[model samples]
Target chain A: MMDSPPGVADLLGVLAYAELTAFLRFAEDATRHAPSLTDRAALGGLAAAEYAHFQLLRDRISSLGVDPEEAMTPFAGPLDEWHAQTAPGDWLETLMKAYVGTGIALDFYREAATRVDDETRDLVEEVLADEGRSQFAVERVSVAIKEDPRQSGRLALWARRLVGEALSQGQHVALARPELATLLVPAGDDITRMFARLTEAHGRRMAALGLPSRP
Target chain B: MMDSPPGVADLLGVLAYAELTAFLRFAEDATRHAPSLTDRAALGGLAAAEYAHFQLLRDRISSLGVDPEEAMTPFAGPLDEWHAQTAPGDWLETLMKAYVGTGIALDFYREAATRVDDETRDLVEEVLADEGRSQFAVERVSVAIKEDPRQSGRLALWARRLVGEALSQGQHVALARPELATLLVPAGDDITRMFARLTEAHGRRMAALGLPSRP
Candidate 1:
């Protein structure tokens, strides 16, 4: 084997841990912030999907002769910190966070997919494939925004903060894992350009939910 | 079509709510109390299974021309109270709760399944089918007991408490929904006999974990 690229394990590890945390956060939001049993079950379904992705990534890490836990441990702190800083306070906020935060992370990973091995890229794309669950958040958030126009400003600010915290945490992870950073923003590619692409995509996502990209 | 059983909706409703709560509780326990990332993911997988069952029951309720949420609403208060009263304090307690509480509930539902309509009985069997996830709890709890013999007494007491609270809240549910009670104990059947069977099954489950049936 030609040494499976420098950061394949790192990328998989980070994504695995991210999916695990996403499962946890989404499950927590479903239990605590969902307005009804129907919504609770809906969010719970999304959480389950995140967990299925976590299992796939973890199994892939194990197949690569790495301890899945050992691979995931390094990113736990930064990701946990990201969730701690962006914990949603209520139902609508929870939906917004799910929509905005997940959108950005998936976009970042999709960008990194281009730099990874074909096998790893396929895995990344598989994990990132939208299963129409995000559309649940979009519909819920959009309907909420329409029902109360004043809420849009607050949700937009929340979305910005979510992206802000994600970026700050992303920088921390990049600094700590240079190889994984290289996977995201290859040797000579402008980091600024990658970020702009992420930001523009995030803007479109926010617009899809009828919210502004900026607070 | 012939009318469904008198309490079929009630049975499905309560069971649906139970599975939903199970998913939420398992996910919460995994995030908050699991001792390792592997265990966390294991519990997350179990949580996902419970959510799948919830979805099935919810869909069954809707298919029967009943509102899923409405069917589930009646049991929410008592079930929520059951969870609120029996919240686990740590990892072992969480495992014990998962093993013991779920064991008793499944047993009760199995007994009730004998009296339900053919289609409903099949659905009940499908939902109650042990997917081997409970073995995860059994192994973990067993290992913990073997590692620290002193912990068994506390866990045994916890198990008793779980059963007691479940029984109390179960009685509350039974009284509030007599038809469901009848479903579990048909006119000619003895409730004491049913309780004995459930208790016997719970004892075997506790024994499987090397824990005392009595505190």
Candidate 2:
């Protein structure tokens, strides 16, 4: 049996842990930060979706003869720290964080997905697919911005901080796990170019919510 | 369109809130108290399952011409209070709470399911059905007790407290919502008999985990 690439396992491990923490944080935020029972249910549904993705990545890691937990442990600290630093203070900030943070991470993973084996690429793409739930964040945030235009500046800054913390933590993870970094920035590709693409997509997302992309 | 019984919406509302809170608490406990990544993922999956049930109950309430949020709001306090009073202290306590607490709630819902309309009964049965995730708790708690038999007393006391708190909050809910109470205790049926059944099932669950059912 031909073994999968080592970097593939590392990539899957990082993604699995991301999904797991996303599940936990989203659920936590929904309970503590949601403005209403309706919004709470919506965010809880999003959390469940993240958990589903976590399960898929976990099974794939195990299939590769890797212990899922062992594969996930190395990335936990950076991910947990990112969450600690970007913890939202209210429902709007929670929505903004979910939108900005998930958008960037999914963009990074989608880029990395292109470098993996066909099966792994397909799995990554499936997990990263936007299920339209992010639309909830967009609609809610847009309405909030429309009602109070002054809030836009603060939310925009919040989005920028989210991306900043994510990138800072991303750098830490990349430095610590060169193999996973290689998965994202392939042999001939520029790391800055990959980040540029992520930033561009993030700009469009921020605009969609009627917020400035940069501080 | 034939409207469902007044009590049916109340019943569904209470259940929707319960499942929503279950999702929140399970996810919170898993993140804060899980001993290992594997256990965390297992509890996260259980939380997702509870969220799925919450969606079902929420949708049912909406279809009945009720606002899901309003329907869920009334039961929030009692359920939240129940959780506040029984917050687990450690990983073992967390597991015990999941196993014992969920067991009694499911038992109570199962009894109340019989008192609803046929369609509602089916939905209730489906939501309350054990998906075997509780076995994770049973196995983990049983092994922990075997490894250190002295821990059994503490865990048993914890389980008893979980039931006591659940019953107390449950009484608060029932008294506050007589329509919901009547759904659980029909005019001819004895409320004590229903409690007896729930207690019996709780004992069986406790025994299966190799812990004494009573303090």
Clashing pairs in 1: none
- What is the fnat of model 1 with respect to the true interface contacts? 0.68
Give one digit per residue, the lDDT tens place, for model 1 in A1-215. 14578777888888899999898889888889998999988888888888888888898888788888988999999999999999999999998888887788789778877887777777788877764677798898888888889999998999899888988888888889988777678677866677788889989988877778998
lDDT of 2 by residue, A1-215 (tens): 05676578888888899999999999999999998988988888888999998999999999888999999999999999999999999999999888887788778777877788888888887876755767788788888988899999999999999988888888788889887777778688877777778889989988877677996
- Each candidate structure's count of clashing pairs: 0, 0
Per-residue CA lDDT of model 2 for B75-138, tens digit only, reads 8898999899998889999988888877876887788777778778888888767657677888
What TM-score fits each model? 0.96, 0.97
The TM-score, computed over Cα atoms with residue i paired to residue i, of candidate 1 is 0.96
Model 2 lDDT, residue A127, Cα: 73
Those runs of model 1 whose alpha carbons end farther than 4 Å from true positions after fitting are A1-3
Shift in Å, residue A116, candidate 2: 0.8
